[model samples]
Target: MISGLDPSGGAGIQADIQAVTALGCHPMPVLSCLTVQDTRNVYNATATDPEIIRQQLECLAADSPIHAIKTGALGNAAVVDVLVEFLAAHPDIPLIADPVIKAAGGGDLADEALIARMKERLFRHAEIITPNGIELTLLGGDEDETRAAHNLLEAGCQSVLATGGHGEGEEIINTLYSHDQEPLYFYIERIGGEYHGTGCTLAASIAAGRASGLSARASIAQAQNYVLRAIRHALKVGNGQPVPDRGIPWET
Candidate 1:
């Protein structure tokens, strides 16, 4: 996993780790950014040094046997460039890039340049890139949901999953697109309350499924179902966004 550390434990790398573990796969974490935030929006974020990022990834790659990689909040262009080097070193590993450009509570996570790097570098190389509505709007090439994913696929990513949570819809729509194939859409009833960290859970769950021997499509389905339960069992913490229940069984 690659992301900022969220002290509230409801989002970012902490959330990714919890979700991956809940799905029963060993999580290999890579810290890309550090932030101070609660269940609400982020307060402040500091991107980790590029050299330190490289060293940590080198250490992990040399010492461990990792199956799949999940990326979250990568801070800036330089950090993303460093991560891109790490990705090049492990071409065989499946990567899930969760493009977290901003916080749910209106805090900016990355600047325009960083987002551009992510769209061009990380998204293009990963097995899958999961972006919510707003990110899709920005990264989505022509500002159209359907077009955004096609643009991403054209950019060389193996697949893209665009979540509908932040869109204007009666029901949330998750559309999965791949190279040389038409997009397949999945619909889920929208949970009524404010929510956060569901994106981290969804991506990491997919990573866990991939690590556990499921293909990208199968893993996506399984991860969707699991996210439903996690949302259904969401617990309110800090009077802000609803925290997803990490205790839910992802295998179901």
Candidate 2:
């Protein structure tokens, strides 16, 4: 299941649905917010009522066994509280959190209080938290990638996938860090030009792979490969950044 909805079809649950379906799993999207935006920029995001969000989650949980959950761009503290309560009830399920703090066009997605609450409440329940370099720095209050990721780990996150896409470099370095294990790195040549929804796509793909019974490491590898391919076939649907082509065929 997903936590947010994006009308743009560039990120959030729209990207989650496409990525999950393309990876061969059914997507159960629970709307947390209604965003007013396009591929260009975000004007505003109105979070759904906490009771309605709670009802949506309860209905889905009662009807079917949720194998995994991928959450993106939670809009407020109320939604965070609702999600925390639900996560507490279902502790065994695998959760992949893509901490969507801001939009690609530089609009705030979540307020400071909501972010703090998420780090405190949601990070512990998540199996893995995927944060791009920028988000990691913001989450950890540290500029260094390794130190920032360590901060999150100390705060109770089991594993951290710190994506280097937002950093300035010739190569994109994605590092997976877990307790007592050396960080595993996946390197890919940096693709030129900006692309939308890469983070959401990657996180949801990982969730799909994990739900289908792949190990955490295996799912990370598969998700990175899938995102790279999607970027390679990215679509320039709007005037701004190109959105990833999530439906592109993957070579088996």
* lDDT against true structure, model 2: 0.88
Residue 73 shift from truth in candidate 1, angstroms:
0.5
Local distance difference test, each candidate? 0.85, 0.88
In model 2, pairs of residues that clash are: none
Top model number, TM-score: 2
Q: What is candidate 1's lDDT per residue for 1-252, written digit by digit as tens?
A: 888898888988888888888888788788888898998899899999989989989999899888888888888899989988888988888988998888999899999999889877877679889998788878876777788778777777788899877766567789998877788888877776667899988999899999888988888888888888888998878878988888866555
Global lDDT of model 1: 0.85
For residues 1-252, write the lDDT of model 2, one tens digit per residue. 655666778888889988899898999888888888788777899888989889989999999989999999888988888998999999889999999898888888899898999898988889999999889999988999899999999999999999888876888889999999899998887887778888999899999999999999889888888998899888888888889999987654
RMSD of each: 1.5, 1.2
Clashes counted in candidate 1 amount to: 1
**How high a TM-score does candidate 1 get?**
0.94
